[model samples]
Target: DEPGLRVKLAEGPQKFYIGVDPTGPSLHIGHLVPIYASAHLQKAGHQPIILMGGGTARIGDPSGKTELRQMISYAQIDKNIASQKPQISKLIDFDNTNALLANNADWLAPLNYIDFLRDIGRHFSVNRMLTFEAYKQRLEKGLSFIEFNYQLLQSYDFLELYRREGCILQIGGDDQWGNIVAGMELIRRVESAETYGLTFPLVTRSDGKKMGKTEKGALFLDSSLTSVYDFYQYWRNVPDADVERFFLTFTFLSVEECRALGAAEGSDINKSKERLAYEVTALLHGEKEAVKAREGAKAAFSGGGDKSGIPSEKIGKAELEAGINILDLFSRTSLCSSKSEARRLVLQGGARVNDVKIEDAEALIGMADAVDGELMLKAGKKRFFRIELTD
Candidate 1:
């Protein structure tokens, strides 16, 4: 019900495409909804072309963003795409005969500007473009020409793919409805192609904030960026109101089963959450990692989890010897963003070292804290980390 399709699908199966720019080092939880939608499409016996927006990343899409995005170097974009490959593979099987990963940079980067403008830009109406939500939102702030051209380039991608792969449909998050409709119009006007555009609702919590974010940041799929334990816990502790909606969106649980689980009273609802955590974690990281993460959660809350699996950072031996403050240590560990935040967490009784809550912000770490090269640093009740002293 959440996938709010904009156009009707044909009576039979068809080929389609879905894409995302590698704007960051890894895809976050926010990205899973569309990717999962692609998976459902793949299972329905249709060709799924996974588009990598290398060309578009150079010019940020302003659909959901409020301001100009900081320009990123090509080197960083390549690294970001490389980091995203594994995550995408886990969801959309590239080995399938119908599945192909295409990069828009291949076609867009080499375009002769004048030729493209003459052939493609002529089809677009600047007057009609101004009416799109993506551009209208930024008009008061003075949208840049480079950013304004993004929709045209993206429209060109759909046209190019339609020719090359027979990809007749495009899908994305609801924020992309304007862009997708633009692409559909481009294909129809240029090739008289019967193309389609569909968009899924942006996954949102009952409270209205977009799902897949924590106080620290977006929940990234990469373990190095967001630990497996933390990833599992993010789902494990979602708001009771969010549990069923997340189950309906993220997992394969049937509607009746989701209803049954969501309707549980009191502490029983936690079981449904645990199931939700395991199912989503398994979808992203595999069942083995999900099992380990679940056990980690149990150990952590039931006194202490496996210290080795907790997210950890190595402190320089000299820094430990000289007595590094607890505040700075948290800042360095990705557990907290700054010393001030760490101090507040410590003073408020949310910071812990070796299972004991910190009573002061000035607490210091040294060699003695390390037991077999690890010490657990618990942030409040749900997050855990390890501090390793090293030379």
Candidate 2:
């Protein structure tokens, strides 16, 4: 049995199970703590059941919310589940293990409204349910009946898993403690079986902001939603104050190893952050992709002094023949937000043409400006765009 498994099974032997909601197609860094915890439990020779809350997602959980979430369509939910499979596979070993992937929709979707009321809904106490943080907040802010049933559905999912898979434990973030306990209670009432709930602390930034989100947006595990380079950079830029907590919750690094990395301090702290980024990225993506992402980051930051260290994009010939306005070109290529921003950048000498600063806001980039059938536009010190002069 796994070391951590002994703790979950302290009183007696119990099967471990964990769950994640497919609220979104990609798992963000915020979801990493529970994911890593589940993976740890799996390695400890306990069963891991990854529950995709397809049914529950339609009636979004009110946990940690100021308002109810917009309901997503079934088609969209299916699409999200399809996209999530690859990312989930990267962390958990799916081969020849007692691991199972289940969708709550399998059971929840088929239940008639009347049957659900009699079979599952009757077990939940209205007064106690209202006491849950998620439900209480919703009621204070005027929650809908649809959202109220979310916990019941989630609890039913837990009961079903407990009966079908012999899953004796459910784990999630601190926010899900009420829901987890609700499931445990339901199992006791309905089947006279005792179940357990364990939750990890919610991962957050040093500044008290939620993890996996930056000024840009949520740092998604899916490379398509967020580029691998940006994903790696997000982890690499964790504040020194939060690095140790991140390592403890996000990586499989032992307590001693995490302590050593945390104690590095000052300039040496970046090395630990880099290793964190690389390992975290490699765990989600592959090592090769992480290496490429790091290379891409180095190339973008190394400046013109080292052209080989920069990531390059290509443009076409006819576009240059049409005489593209430098501002318009920059905006079209996503180098700047708008033509005005591009013009301001040019006037401020922040815009560069083929590594040469362009001081003229009205600069006309024609075929004459094309170098090797391409015009490399640099916005600020980091962003690069290649304008291909077609025909």
Candidate 3:
């Protein structure tokens, strides 16, 4: 926070906002920090405005992008907004009168181009705009005129929200700092009002990999996009060095508890990781799903506890009786996306069926491989899949 923000916050309950563009249909784990921050603030008696960038999403945010973002249809953007609300609502209470869900399209879609240029466009200086890190980086890769205008539109969002909703602060990732400051400047210039901006650090693991990123892709909040079990496992497998920071950043646990849990050593750290996974998963999915996922992980890893949580696919009993190649069987489940990938996994000694390492890609899997009408397939040490035999 800027120096004045502390004093401003002390002044009484002030409304703060965070803007999200519906660029994708699902909210990834990357989106959770600010949402959790908003929830924390709202719990402390401040109002929260969750601005849905329906209009600006059309232009797309150029910040943190190396190339022009692919444009999606307005229908898709709207669908994305709808998809995101429930995920956000898991933390932010939409039922509260003080919480607002705003769409920038409501005002921006009806604007007259010339009028906007005369009113809002005249305030931004191109030379200064280019100096912002977002544009400076984009300039090397060719910044589009549409992308260049994003900061201005985003600034207008702050100004408009201030006028209508009395919102005075913006929160987002540190990558959004330039835009957030631009909005603060715009609010100061246009309304002669002092507004604030706060940004959360870009979270990463101790190994320097991005937080919530998996070999599969981003850890999406939508179970269909990233399965609930996989989501649980991602946190469950977080590097020991990351446990404390992630607990403080991602969960509502107290500082002392997070520190103590993060300090766990050797085998004890695994329990801390499991608790972290359960807490985070419960926050996103329901507690029931988190328990199931935990049990599924335990079952898959140790062969004890509920096996129902493991990801499974059904195949005919006749198919297994007829026999399928090891590579082909792996390709059939989420364990592998294609036969070529399965071949690579098998050749690398990462493939297993019924707890036995599969050394040959061409090895045939028959009904003999089934244990209790199911085949437990393992990829590497962590990935597991259950293939169920059906009549």
Supply every candidate's count of residue pairs whose N, Cα or C atoms clash at under 3 angstroms. Answer: 3, 12, 0
Candidate 2 lDDT, tens digit per residue, 1-391? 2355456566554566666667788888777777787787777666678888888988898888889788789998888888887778887788988678888899888889998899888888889988878777777888888888878888998899988888888888999999999998999999998777888886767887778886447788876667676677778788899888777777788999987887788889988988888888888888987887676566555532323223344556665666777787777755566788788888888888778777877777877776666677787765565554444
Q: State every prediction's TM-score relative to the real structure.
A: 0.91, 0.85, 0.97
RMSD of 3: 1.2
* TM-score: model 3 vs. ground truth: 0.97
Top candidate by TM-score:
3
Q: Which ranges of candidate 2 are over 4 A from the true structure?
A: 1-13, 303-313, 321-391
Model 3 stretches with alpha carbons more than 4 Å out: none
Ranking by lDDT: 3, 1, 2
Better of 1 and 2 by lDDT: 1
How do these models rank on TM-score, best leading?
Answer: 3, 1, 2
Whole-model lDDT, model 3 = 0.91
Candidate 1 on 1-391: residue-level lDDT in tens? Answer: 2233333343566778888788899999888888888887887677788898899999889887878998998888889988898999888888836788888999999999999889988989999999988889889787999998999999999999999988888989998988888998999898986787878887778777768888788899999888898899899888899888888888877899988888887989999899999999998999988988888787667856454555667777777778777888888877798988898899888988877777787788776766666677888877877777777
Best by lDDT: 3
* Tens-place lDDT digits, model 3, residues 21-123: 7999999998889999999999888999999999999899999999999999999999999999999999999893679999999999998989999988888
lDDT of each: 0.84, 0.77, 0.91
